[model samples]
Structure formats: structure tokens, C-alpha cells
Target: MRVFAQLFEAIDSSTKTSRKVAAMVDYFDRVSDEEKLFAVALLIGNKPKRPVATTSLREWASALAGIPSWLFEESYYAVGDLGETLTLLMPQQSRPEETPTLKAVFATMTALRKYSPMEQRETLYTFWTTLRGTALFLFNKMLTGSLRVGVSRKLVINALARHLDRDEATVAHQLMGKWDPLTTRFTDLFPQQGTALPHHIPYPFYLAYALDREPADLGDINNWLLEKKLDGIRGQLIRRNGELFIWSRGEDLLTDKFPEFGPLTTLLPDGTVIDGEIIPWKDGHPLPFARMQTRIGRKNLSAKMLQEVPLVMVCFDLLEYEGRDIRHEPLLIRRAQLAALIDNPALQRILLRSEEMAFPDWQAAADFRERARQFHCEGLMLKQWQSAYGVGRRKGDWWKWKADPFSIDAVMIYAQSGHGRRANLYTDYTFAVWDGDTLVPFAKAYSGLTDTEIKSLDRWIKQNTVEKFGPVRRVKPVHVFEIGFEGVQASNRHKSGVALRFPRMLRWRLDKTAAEANTKDDLLDLLRLYGQ
Candidate 1:
């Protein structure tokens, strides 16, 4: 536990990637096999389930600190982090050279879930009193399931590859599957030493840069491939050895959830991997993203539900063919192969190609982006004709030029503190549209605001707060701001009878008041305008 805490401090203290990689390698060399596995899992977003509720933890912590609960709440609001607040409130104690191992400590936490809440609280109180400084903070963070430091997942993979003198892709593929920290050893992670991996594993996704300018800013239009930008979940469909696997861009195995794509196992030949977008389709048109949400997170799909919300994979690129990786090939070659395969009668219904549009000039591509909504696409995807498939973000070879977002005026209704650096400020907010004389909450936006703007709004929110619900404050809806989004849909869950995708504050409307905010009907009109 002490070594892990030191590792956390080392990671948190550095901002440079080189320093972070060195810190991870230094700690990796000092811990046991189980400790190394546990640390790897935590760093890569594989945290264990929190055994106790946060409210109970706050109460127990306050009692141990000999402070009132209200005082603790105020400190928490000021600190903007429960774990940090509790760690600071606890009196510093003597440090011990050795403590419990990371695995043993984690086992104690998981076992506490079987005990009564009172018993659990007592155990936590005793543990808090024993641990001090960085160790206490580590325990609090692990218990609350918020143990993220500055170190990123990519940095961890890079460090492992450099230490073992192995390829980065091989290290990433080994960490791709559902791994158990309790059973998997540190050496087990790299037994292959960068050799062949299991057939079901999906390759790392290739990303694009945002093109904020005209396509003509580059070179001749003939050197690029332009396709309509899809508004769906990016995924990869793997067909190997007569079995199929579907992996979301988030690295989730989704084959069972999307059984409609199961026919691909027999339709496509063995040893082929196709990359595409998983979209909600109806009558040959892409439906709103809300329709796609209905099919997500469900293992069992009824016949009626499946019929109501059908799915299709719009092929984007070909990653593998005939039991070999073809990512080294040119873009046009991969597209031609993918097109030929999708032309089959049995596979044509489930898989569709993203047909490239011909443009005589750059102005033609710019004009197409303006009318992207007409074809139910986000914008245009511009790729170089000879660019090879690569991992992660690489500039110049590919770009996504999305259409301007739909914007509307709305009022801030709720405010909450942010995490990390913004924890001391009420930077997160919920916006609302006018429904007759009352304000109805619709979308929550926390980004796209300048740091200066956030500071000003944070001060205003504290003064205008009319009611408080825990960390949330119901502020006076006097200020108006413009909200921008990509799409809108009807939702029974929201009070405004609407839901907006990727909502963010475009700009503050200092000239407008709450009365000038848009109406709920106006949003509904937008829903209609965007094929909601």
C-alpha cells in the first residue's frame, strides 16, 4: 500500500509524459506480481465496485474527525472532492515502513460489503485512523472509485513496451480483453513477448483530426477520398474461425448485444475483419441516435423490438483480409476490397459501404458539407487516397469536417462543482428552456467555456442560489446563454420532453434575460427540422 501510494504521488506530481512513464516503471519494478496487476487494472479504468455508499462514508469520516456533518459538507463543497476533503480532515498520524499489500487491502474492502453498514463504517474508521497522508488519500480514492491521477492509459502501455523491449501494439492487444487482476500475474500479461494474439481481439481504432477550414486549403481534390461523415457508434466486426465478435470503439465486446449482425458469420468468409459504424436504421434511412440507445445495454432482443429498431453496419475501412493484417495497404485498395466483399447478395443487406462522393474542386466539397443534414450525415470525411491505416490520432492523412452545430438560447437552472482542477468552482451546469411561464430542464452542459467565463459564472452562481440539494444548487434563472448540439430527439425521461446530443455552451448572451430564452416548442421544432 505504501509503494502504491508513492507511485500515485509520483504520477500526480508530473505533467510530462516522459516523467510519468519513468514513475510507472520505477513503481512496477518495486511491487509484487499481484500488486503490479492490481495497479495496472486501476490505472487503465478497471476499478473494483465501491463497497460503501459515499453518503455513509462522508458521515463516518466526519464523526472520526470530531467535526459536525454540516462542517464536513461545507469543506467538501469547498474542496469539490469527497476523497480529498476526508483525507485533509483526518489528523496526521505516524508513518509505518510497511503496511498491508494492495491486494490484501482490496480484499478487505470487497469483504466489507457482506457486513452491516454500521460494521463497515467501524472498519473504515479504524483504517482511516491508522493510515496517514498519501496512504489515506489512496484508500479514500480507491473506496470511492475515483483513483485517477494524471497518468493516462496510453502512457502506461508505452512504459510497459519500453521496459520489455516489445512493440506497443502487442502490449495493447494483451491488455484488450476482460482480465482478472486476482488471477492474472504480472508476467502473464506479456507471455507472448509481442507475438501473435488471440484471433478475437480487435485492433486499435484509427482517429481523425477536425478540419475547421475549407477542403481547398489543402491540395487538388483528386488526391483525396471524401465520404459522408456517419453519425453512429464506431465499431469493428471480427469474423474468424466461423465465429463473430463485435467490438465498440470503447473496447466493449458487443457481439451478443447486437445479434442482428450475427448472420455475418456465415455470410462473410473466415479470417476477415471489417471496421464500420453501428447505426440505427429504418426503411434505408439512418434514424436519430435515440433509436440506437434502445438496442444498447440489452442482451435479449424481442422480435417486435428488433423489428422496430433495426441495425446496420456502414463499412468504413478494411483492417484485415484472408487471415492477415492489411493496414499497411493504401486507402483506395482497402476500399475497393471492402466494396467487393459487401457486394455479395447475402451480406449486402446487413453491410453498406460509405460511398465516396466525386468532386471537381474544393468548393464542391465545401458545398456538400453545408448540406450534410439533408443526407442524415454529420459532415464530410476527407482521407488521402494513399494513406495507410494507422493507430490513434495522426494529422494530415485524414480529417472530419462537421457541419455547424444547431444552437439555441437557454437559461442556467442548476449548478454543481467540477472534478480535478475545477473542483473548487461550480463549473458544471444544467440548462433549461422556457415552458410557458416555468423553466423546464432539458440539457446539461459542462464544457466549451473559457476559464475566465467559468470563474465569473461560479461567483454568480453562489450569490444567486435559491435552493440547495446536496452538491447541486438551484440558481436563479436570470442569465441566458446559447447552447449548441449536433442532434435532438424526443425523450420521456426529460421534463422538457426533449433530449439534445453533445450539448455545450456556445457563448453567453449578456444582452438577453431569462424571459428571452427559447421555448420548449422551439426545441421541438428543431427536433422536427433535424428529422427527430
Candidate 2:
């Protein structure tokens, strides 16, 4: 546990990827196999269920520190993080005679749910006195399920692959599906004999980076394959050993969520895995993304609801066929195989192949890209004809040329503090649009500002605050910001009767005033034009 805590500090304090990877590799080298397995699980966001209520934890910490509850609350508001607040407020303890193991600590946490609240508090107090410094901080964070550091899953995979002297793609593939760290072994995760993997496991998705240059800069359009970038959940449909499994890119199991696709288990050949997008289809076109959200997380879907928002997996590429892995094959060959598999009369309604778009040149492609919103597509995907399905995100082979985001000038009406590094600054903001003489809150954005800009705006927000409501401050609407979003739709839940998708600050419109900002009518116009 002490070594793991040191590793946490080392990872959190550094911004360099190489330094972080080195720290992880060194930690893996020194830890037990069980510790390495759990560490990998935690690093990849498979956190254990939080066992204790945060309110109870805060009250117990304040009692242990001999500080008043009001003082602790004030400290938490200032700290902006419960874990950090508890670490700073609690009194120091004497060093333990022996350090605890990560697995033991995890076991203790998982068992807390069986105890009563009083028993839980007593156990936590006894456990808290045995640690000091980073270990104590990490323990609190683990209890709160907020142990985040500056490392990507790719970096962790890289470090593990280097330490084990294994292929990076193999290590990545091993980490994909459901596995219990408590029972899993390091050797089981990365086998030496090229053992068969679990049938439910998915391959590491091949992601595309955004294209920054013009399409014409790529040299020739004939050398690329073009397809509409559908706005849907990217998933992999696998049929293995007469069983069907649909895994989202986030690693969520969607088999029961979309029962309509269950027939594909018999329709598709054994040991076939196809990569595609799961979209809500109606009348041969995709419904709005907002409509798709209605069918998500419904374990038992009503027949009426399924009929209204039917889902179809638009196949893009074939990953496996007839029990063989074909990811190394060229895109041209893979697409041809996928087309042949999806061209079935029985699978027409449930599975549709993403049709390749034809264009004479880059100029024609650009012109077609402008009309992507009409077909409910995000934009165009350009894939190299001879590219292979690689792991994670790689440049040069696949690129996403997205349509320009819709922009509107809106006024900053409320401000809130951010967590982690921006804990002390007013980095989150609520934007409003004019509704006659009233200002209606439309969107809240928290990104797209430089460090200098955030600091400057934080100062302005502190001075312009009109009223306080807990962590949120109602600020005077004096500054205007250009807010950008991918799509807009009519929403009864919003005060403006509209909602924006992926809203973020594009730039600070210093030359514009609150009075000159866009109105609710302008948002309604966007909904009419882009709304499904």
C-alpha cells in the first residue's frame, strides 16, 4: 500500500508521459502479482463500488479531527474535493509497524457493505490510524471512488507490455472485457502460450483522429474510402459458439438493451465479430440522438417503445469471420467481406451496411460534407484503402472530417468552482440567451479556455458575483462568449425549450455585450433547421 501510494504521487505530480510510464513500470516490477492485477484494474477505471456514504465519512473525519462540523464543511467548500479535504483535516498518526497490502485494503472496503453504520465508522477509525501521508490520502480517495491520476489507458498498457516483454496489442486485448481482479491472476491476464481468450472479450477499438488539414491535402481521393460518420454508439457485435454479445466502446454490455439484434446470433456465422455503430432508425433514416437516449439502460423494453425507436447496427468493418481474426487484413478486403456478410435478406432490418460514398474529387466530397446534417450524420470518415485495423488511436490511416459546430454568442450568468487542479478557480459557467427582457439559461460549459484566460475570468467572476447559492454564484451578465455545439434539438426539460449537444466555449467575445448576445428565437431557429 505504501509503495502504491508513492506511485500515485509520482504519477499525479508529473505531466510527462514517459515519466509516468516509467513510474508504473517500476511499481509493477516491485509489487506482487495480485497487486499488479488490481493496480491495472484500478488504472483502467474498474473501481470497486463505493462502500460508505460520503456524508458519513465526512462526519466521522470531522469527529476524529476534533473539528466542528461547520468548520469541516467550510474546509470542504474551499478544498473542492472530499478526499483532499479529509486528508488535510485529519490529525497525523504514528507510522505503522507494518504496511498493508492493496488487496487487503480492497477486501476490507468491499466487506464494509455488510456492516452497520456504527460498525463501519469504528472500523474506518481503527484502520485510519495505521497509515500516514500519501497512504492515508490514497485510502480516503479509494473509499470515495475518486482515485484519478494523469495517465491514459494507452500509457498503462504500454508500461505493462514493456515490463512483461509482450505485444502491446495483446496486452490491450487481454484487458478488455469483464474480469474480477480479486480472483484474476497476472499470468491469466497475459498468458505465455497464446491461450484462448474469453468469448465475451472485445478487441481494442481502432480510433480515428480529427483531420486538421483540408481533404485535398491528402493527395488523391481515389486512394481513400468515404462514409458518413454516423452519430450513434460505436459497438462490436460478436457471435461466438451460438451466443451473441454486443459490447459498447466504453466496455458496457448491451445484449439485453437491444433485444432486436438477438436474432443475429443464428443469422451470422459462428465466431464472427463485426464493428459498427448502433443507431436508432425509423423510416430508413436515423432518429435524433436524443431519441436514442430513451432506449438506453432499459432492461425490460416495452414493445411500443422498441417499435417507435428501433435500433439497427450499421456494419462498418469486419474484425473476425469463421473463427479467424482478420484485423491484419487491408480495409479494401475487409469491406468486401463485410458487404457480402451483411447483404442478406433476413438481416436487412436488423443490420445495414454503411454505404461507401462516391465522389469525383476532394471538392465534391467537401460539398457533400456540408449536407451531412440533413442525413443526421456528424460528418465524413476518410479511411486509407490499404490501411489495417490498428489498436487504439493512430494517425495517418483514418481521419474524421467533422462538420463545423453551430456557434452562438451567449452571456455568462452563473459560475462554479471546478475539481482537481482547477479546484480554487471559477472554471465552470452557465450561459444564458435573451428571452424578450428575461435571460434564460441555455447551456453550461466548462472547457475551451487557456490557463491565462481561466485565471483572468476567475478574477472577473469573483468581483461580479451578485448572489451566492452554495458553491454556485449568480453573476451579473456583462461578458459574452461564443458557445459552440454539434447539434440542437427541442427539449421540454430545458428552460429555453432547447438543448445543445457537446456545448463548449469557443472564444470570449470581448467586443460583444450582453444586450448583443443571441436570443431564444435564434436557438429555436437552430432547432428547426437541425432538429429531427
Global local distance difference test of model 2 = 0.89
- Model 2 misplaced stretches (Cα beyond 4 Å): 94-98
- State the C-alpha lDDT per candidate: 0.85, 0.89
Instruction: Give lDDT tens digits, candidate 1, residues 185-240.
Output: 77776675545676788888888999856677778889999988988889999999
What TM-score does each of the candidates earn?
0.93, 0.97
- Per-residue error for 191 in candidate 2, Å, reads 1.7
**Span of ten consecutive residues with least summed lDDT in model 2:** 90-99
Best by lDDT: 2
Question: Each model's number of backbone clashes?
Answer: 0, 0
